[model samples]
Target: MKNNKPDQQLASRRNFIKGSALAAAGFFIVPRHVLGGPGFIAPSDRLRVASIGVGGMGAGDVRGIFSSGKVDMIALCDVDDTRAKQSREAHPKANYYKDYRIMLEKEEKNIDAVSVSTPDHMHAVQALMAMKMGKHVYVQKPMSHDIYEARMLTEAAEKYKVVTQMGNQGSSGDGVRQMVEWYNAGLIGEATKVWTWTNRPVWPQGIPWPSTPIAPPADLDWDLWLGTAPYKDYVGNLVPFNWRGWWDYGTGALGDMACHIMEPPFRVLGLGYPSSAECSVGSVYVGEFQRGYFPDSCPPSSHITLRFERPGKEELEFHWMDGGIQPTRPEELGPNEMMGDGGNGVIIEGTKGKMMCSTYGANPQLLPTSRTKDVSLPQTEYRVPGGSSGHYNNWVEACIAGHGSEEFKKLSSPFSVAGPLTESVLMGNLAIRSYDYRIPRTGSDNQFDYPGRGIKLVWDGANMKITNFDPANQFVKRTYREGYSL
Candidate 1:
């Protein structure tokens, strides 16, 4: 008797991955039942994967996933062919597409996971779509462009029972865990003040949007590239990297580097959302007569303060400075000692002592260089096998092992941890953006009232809202474009 059921044929089609003949024929799969049943995936079974925005950071992510030796990258997508050219040449067999939606639809049966490394504005939408289709996701840091989106993805991961990881590689580093061990060992007493800074926005910020109306590059799909953001004329430099300086397409320096700098303190202090947030942005001189007020772009530099209510102690005061601004030298440091790894660093001031670390939570040290060498603490946390670079393989193996497996729980920056951290990080930007919100003063054509200035915005973490300032609430969640809804 000849037997050929449709479901069996589909399963057969979905089960043959990584063969010269199969790939050359544009078919990829993992022999479903041959490896193992249900939760037990075999060592030889390769997870089929896809990537969106395979250029720049996207290209790095895809390459890392492929390097893990646990997955077969079957599809690659990007809006700009020029940007994706390198990746295409590297993985010519993996189907390439300019439209992610079409790629997902056509390859749904073959893909086991998706990596999203697009612009801040598009991350949530792309990841959300993949999650809805029961695909595991690895998203880049800051979780999302909005606090609401972060919360949604956090909840969705649990709802869909899909393994998830955020691309804050530092969260998996030895430095952060070592700091956590030190903090838990009471080496640094109750943390009362923390400061973090970076020299970012090497791109232009705090200026009017480029008014030049020019055609977009032939290789770039301007409409698709602007996914989730409002339609606008093409501007040079904004597409490749300068977008980080704009509010509409990016989240400024906070989004650019805070996830890397702040993860250590967020983990060691065991902090959550701040009770109140405030900031002071550096001003730019637009014309000789009046100061510039460009809401379209981020400020040239800024200093922000976030207050958290500690369960048993006084409130914690955390400061964030960017655009090369740094705190005064700590007395514990030597005159020649560089503060915070130079250019970017973090300082945690505790009731009894202080600790500091450089970017990516690397090269941690105690104040007064002598203390760093003198003190020793137990390694209380499990060290990530490959350290920071192991971040990609960590997620890939987990997806292969199946969601809710023991291996899955060991992920470094799962949505569970990343969501609150992202929400808290984005909180600082809310304060910075609010500083620019204004209204015209009544009966005065010559004057304007800045409503968001000079106030501490009280936050309701549970609801993701700004209880004190109504206007600032808008940033907690944004209105997406018509086609892209979360």
Candidate 2:
């Protein structure tokens, strides 16, 4: 069945191209309705798209592009045959290649945009290369593995006149828009402190190294998978999905979830890059092996606090607690409005009244409670016009029409916000790796005195450098493998 699916996909593409040519030639033609509907642009008018790293996330992206009717999927690229096969089956009419560069060089003009769903480490290079070719880009979240790449991609997107959207799906949802609405409404006064948490500490939980290498999968090109990271023999356990836990490939739990968790606080508060950020480690994972592989023993769950000294007056602190972490609720919050365990959300404590929101607050409804009863929120419905379809649809529309509209911008324009948030999360990961260190922390609630511990690191956004701590800056920028320099 799997083998037949690829063959069928290929046949459908060949037929579509043949049929499209006939219609363009002014000959009598019949519509087959390849995509979900016929309202989208025809194949000839569609943007040519190329898919890179078409495995899990990549395959889903391919489907989105093909279904949008805004683009014709011309190429499928991936290091793994299993995923490549999935994309090929989903888009048989497009050319297929194992290596993305080969597809880029071979089908240069055949593509107008590139959808990149690779690992955290490969995002910067793939997107940068596509932008350099004048191709629009839709990359997955945490935009880049480090600060330098994030800054570079943001600049390059502007320079190349390409439309860009980072793939934080929540960024394209109504929930995020509602968060913005509530923030604008001042439901949370002043917005002094923000707390976000995740139930991570699962795969890469608590700063541990990965296990030893195993034989690479037969259908997978392991070397290509490693991409820009330092070469390590294929570890069977790490590939496919566990990459999220390792320092070399993934951004740990904080990196994986912070973009989603931090969006509300950033949008509502209009917070910029923090002047300083330090990580506090409740438990540490020691040894170089810990840096390289997953440790057999898990590190204790801990909270990472990031402090920002805002422009106006007092300092603001955003605490990111994960691995079974919860925030200390303000006394004002009703008993029933208390947050959930094994779930994710953010709590904003303000002087006037406290505002609580979950990570996935689908449709702006608060968790029902008797004591809290029904807190009347304004009946404002903010919809993601094209996003109701998919994240790639918004990008496809923007790519074809030039500039993204206000709605599209509102949906996917969190790159600037997500960039700094990712940095703070990565910094937290670094702090945890530094073992048990009493780093300095300053920032109080309501001008009250409060002292804390963690490595107090200062940041210089202008220079993209974090001073006062050298070790903290180690993860700020990454080096490229021999041939993959962007």
Candidate 3:
């Protein structure tokens, strides 16, 4: 698909030249205070940012980026006025618009960077547009809605030569870095099995879509809110939240939390795409004994296993559980001890020992808990300033420094790394969706048959295809609405 319009193409070329010129002459440029007022910041010293979906997590992202004291939030965009109110009130000097497309078009030259905190489905389209315009991007976690979008965004970052960061803040945390060091020192040995769990679906899932639609709120531009997703009538409770359960918009539990919970293992193990995927999902009982079938919504609970091939080592078995499901606890812990912060956590079992951590890789501990106190390892990985809290400023500084600079190299979750990780996370979702793939039975006692159940789907990660089941490949990519493309 053509990624840019004629005007956008011109703007992209102009922006590229402008960025190149600024990078070339940055060292020689005079201080802004010398040229203007004492409070003025030089173009090279400040990052002018525009934020899309400036509400919910987006509001926090805006606050974090602005707190860097080196960012000028020049533009803000959101489809809902009520949701954008907080950012608008906070950044009164910034321009505001409901449509991101118009904001990008009008303010293209003014923005040096863009932050996209939209839903999973719209992430690729919004971020791609900014990247094509030579704007550095900080996208929210589960970088894209599908495997294809993730791969495309990964390639685009390199092609555009822009500094990029994904919103999995844990990647920048000291805990993850500490875990990496310990793992490198053979503390956990060679990890063979990894388990991650979450108590999500804090929204709702495994239920049928609302039978009736309601009018969208007066403050909301419902059409714009449904950007890349298929057009659907406004439904109650879907605006501010609750969209996470629907397949049309959100990516369910796996997409919601796996990026945060799975990153430590993914980074420590130097993992790549999975070689195979399979899953078993919890079903809801409808009235009495009948099982609920709602393909349009994510299942209420699920247990997914993915296998990653290692060149010289045994294949790694990675397990993900959601809807309060958890793996069997290691016997090394006391019966009363909490496993993974009581709600969400990760455990990596290796030949020698096991290590565990809570969400975002916080509070990392070795198995038996006592081993964590005496063991020490040299710090091999660079920790981001302020740890996880420094994630926003890290990207801001990197953008100001320009791509390929030293600061850029220190990025925690650039698309190059986030893309593969996100793809792996979404692989679990693929297995879940495939598990619900139903077929009509011909001249049989059963009304419907599920061939995908109880079968391991062989994956060709490079090709983004499920080799064993052709039907499962349908979830790898999706058709966007009429006005959007990626």
Structural similarity to truth (TM-score) of each candidate: 0.91, 0.80, 0.92
Q: lDDT values of the candidates?
A: 0.89, 0.69, 0.94
Best of the candidates, TM-score: 3
Candidate 2: list runs displaced more than 4 Å: 1-45, 206-212, 282-300, 330-342, 360-382, 386-390, 404-411, 433-453
Candidate 1 Cα outliers beyond 4 Å, as residue runs:
1-44
Q: Write the per-residue lDDT of candidate 1 for residues 154-202, one digit (tens) a residue.
A: 9999999998999999888999998888888888788989999999878
lDDT of 2 at 374: 53
lDDT tens digits, residues 223-267, model 3? 999998888899887868899899989999999999999999999
TM-score for predicted model 3 compared with the true structure: 0.92
lDDT of each residue in 1-486, candidate 2, tens digit only: 257988899999999999999989988835545553756445555788888888888888777777766677888888899867877887778888888888888888778888888998889888889989998888877788777888888778767777888776666666666656666666655767778887865774444444676788899988888999889888655778888766677777776777777766776676766776655444443665443223332244667766777777578888888777687755655576547333787776664455666664333333232322455557464566654356667677777767546534644553555566556556666555543323334573433221223446677766776677665565567788899987
Best by lDDT: 3
Better of 1 and 3 by TM-score: 3
Rank candidates by TM-score, best first: 3, 1, 2
Q: Model 3: runs farther than 4 Å from truth?
A: 1-41, 444-446
Alpha carbon lDDT at 104, candidate 2: 86
lDDT, ranked from best to worst: 3, 1, 2
